[model samples]
Target: MNKKYIQCIGTFSIALPLLAAIILTGITSIVKAHLLGNFAESKNTYKTEQAQIAVLNELKIQHSKKQTQLKQWNQLLTGDSFTKVNERLRQSIADSNKTKTLQLTDAKRSTRPTYAVNAPRSACEFKLEGTFSEMQRCLTKLECRMPNLMINTMSLNSQINSNLLNLKLNYTIWENAQ
Candidate 1:
């Protein structure tokens, strides 16, 4: 080929790979964005609604019904914006009565906890003392009921026949609809 023609062909060959790479990357990004965009339509649209509903469902799973389990679930979920879910928790707790009331303090996270994406949650620190059997029963109750009660610490001290259990129970509730 002539020098000018050869130069044009060389330039096109050199640019071709870069142009192809750019187009491929752009297409990939658009596909990714399209997948993620499916969720961010409006502030309180389908995604938010679904998240809220999931919060309720999780409450149901966590507040699985048992006497003591129900008690804590009710207390945690009550009187908040998540009241509907709390009501569901309350109803679950109403199913049992073997537990006494326990105190829970709203605790600040030293660090923002790792939580599910788009999950608006609040944390509480719960402490309670019970006899060995009672404590086991309580934990069992918690295990049965609470959907999101992350156990930070659990300690048990033996007392006579019944042991004394000092436990720190951490739980979370969704702050917003989700």
Candidate 2:
């Protein structure tokens, strides 16, 4: 009976440590899996946030470009009244005529169709006589000096026995709407 009791105590001591080791390993595995899951979830959330930030940055760049273009367009617009604009146009044409052989034969103002909803425009028809080179120089000066003036139509006819050309020019001036 004493030997049997000793054997039972040995068996119980070994089994207790083995069972404790197994239980501890199971708990460790469960904790590791939970931690790994949380890490994965956080990583996914970070990626989503980064994607949204990139999109917003792209949109911001596009908006900045649009603003710059708008500013440049505004620089090409005149805020003066139609009468003032017309006077300026005539003065410019006269100035061009003085520098070159271009002669202003006739000038007329006509009603022009508006191209923009918020911008008003004026049109003028001009008849001039000059050589081709003189006409070219005059047109170049007008275009470069007055950014608001746009040439809508131009026609040139050569005289039967002369070096001079008859030029018909239609131009439009864009003004800022009040």
* TM-score for each predicted model, relative to the true structure: 0.33, 0.48
What residue runs in model 2 are displaced by over 4 Å at the alpha carbon?
Answer: 1-100, 114-118
Instruction: Kindly give the stretch of ten consecutive residues in candidate 1 with the minimal lDDT sum.
Output: 102-111
lDDT of each: 0.53, 0.76
Task: Tell me, by TM-score, which candidate is best.
Answer: 2
lDDT of 2 by residue, 67-172 (tens): 9767855755745434544555456566666546668788777668556555677787878888887677667766765677777888999989988899998888
Tens digit of per-residue lDDT, candidate 1, span 121-165: 655444555444554554565545555445544444444654444
Q: What ranges in model 1 sit over 4 Å off? A: 1-112, 146-148, 152-162, 174-178
Residue 148 lDDT (model 2)? 74
Determine the backbone clash count of candidate 2: 0
Report the alpha-carbon TM-score of model 1 versus the true structure.
Answer: 0.33
